[model samples]
Target: MLDKQVCRNIKMVLLDVDGVMTDGSIFINKDGEFCKSFNVKDGLAIELLRSHNILVGVISGKASAALDTRCKHLGFDEIITGCKNKLPALVDICSKYNISPSQIAFLGDDVLDIPIFEKVGLGIAPVDAHCLAIANSDWVSTLKGGEGMVREFVDLLLINKLDLPLKDIYKPLLDKIRYDDVAIMEQ
Candidate 1:
C-alpha cells in the first residue's frame, strides 16, 4: 500500500521512456526513421494526472523524434532528452519546482534508472522491469510496459483520488493535441 500521505504530497511524476513506456523495443525504418510504441491509456493517464495539477514529464537516456513527438502531443511540462545521466536532470526539475524528492514519483525499469529510485519519494516499476529496478521500487505495477502499466500506476495513485466532475471525464482537455507533424505511436 502506498502511504496516503505520500500520495497526497506527490506534486510531480517523472517517467523513463524506453522500457517503462514502450516495452523496450526500438525499430528503425528503411527511411532512417525511428519507431516506438506508446500506450494511449498511458497517455490518457498522464493527461488525468496533469488535470489534477500534478506535473508530468519524460526523461530519456536516448533521443528520438518519436519521444519529442509523443511528449509534445501529451502537453508535458518538461521534456529532457539525450540524458546520459538522469540524476542531474532530476535535481534540476526539483530545483525548478522548488520541491524536494519526497514530493515526486519516478517510474523506471533498468539499472540506469537506479539513481532516480534512490532519490525519489516513490519509486515504481513495471512488472517486467529488471530485477534491480524492482528491488529499489516502492511500488510495482502488475502490467507490462506499453500494456497499460502506466495506467495501473495512475489508478493506484489517482483513480478515485480526485474530485473531478463528470463533465471533465466526458471531455478531458488532454485529448486535444496540436500535432504539427505526423503523431502516432511507433511499434
Candidate 2:
C-alpha cells in the first residue's frame, strides 16, 4: 500500500535503468555494441502518465547509446546518465523541475538507489531487486524488472491520484486512442 498523501504529492517519477527497466541484463553484439530489451507495456505506461501530466525521467549510473535512444523515443522530461553519485542528480532534478523531493517518486533496484529512496516521496522496488533495496523501499511490485512493473506502479499512481477505481483509471487512455484513430481516419 502507498501513502495517499505521498502519492498525491508526486509531480514527477524518476527511474533507474538496468535493473529497474531492463532486468539488469547487458547484451553485447558481435560488434561489441550493447543491446537492451524494453517492455512495450512500460512504454505505454509512460504515455499514460504523460497524458495525465505527470512528468517522467531517467537516471542511470551506466551510459549506453541504447538507453539514449529509448529515452528519446519515450519523450522523457529529463535524462541523466553516467552518474554514479545520484544524489546530486536528484538535487539537480528538483531544482530544474522546480519541485521538491517530496514531489518525486523513484523506482530503483540496487544499492545505488537507496540514497534516492531516502529523499523521494515514494520509493518503489521490483520484487526481484536486491534484498537491501527491497527492504528499504516504501513499496515493492509483485513483478520483476522489465516485466510490466512500471505499468503496475503507474496503475497504482493513477488510482490514487485520480481517486478512481482500478478499472476506471485506463478510461482516459482508451478515449484518447479512440479520438486519435478517428482523427486519422478522417484525414
Instruction: Choose the strongest candidate by TM-score.
Output: 2
Write down the lDDT that model 2 would get. Answer: 0.93
Q: For candidate 2, write residues 32-96 as lDDT tens digits.
A: 99999998999999988998899999999999999999999999999999989999999999998
- Give candidate 1's whole-model lDDT: 0.85
- Model 1 per-residue lDDT at 175: 49
In model 2, which regions exceed 4 Å deviation? none
Q: What C-alpha RMSD separates each model from the true structure?
A: 6.1, 1.0
* Residue 94 lDDT in candidate 2: 97
State how far residue 31 of model 1 sits from its true place (Å). Answer: 2.6
Q: Point out the worst 10-residue segment of candidate 2 by lDDT.
A: 166-175
lDDT of 1 by residue, 1-187 (tens): 6777778788999999998889889999999899999989899889878867899989889899998999999999989989979999999999998999888899999989999999998999999999999999999999997888888887677633453444554244434443312265331
lDDT of 2 at 12: 96
Give the winner by lDDT.
2
Off by over 4 Å in 1: 159-187
Backbone clash tally for model 1?
1
RMSD, candidate 1, Å: 6.1
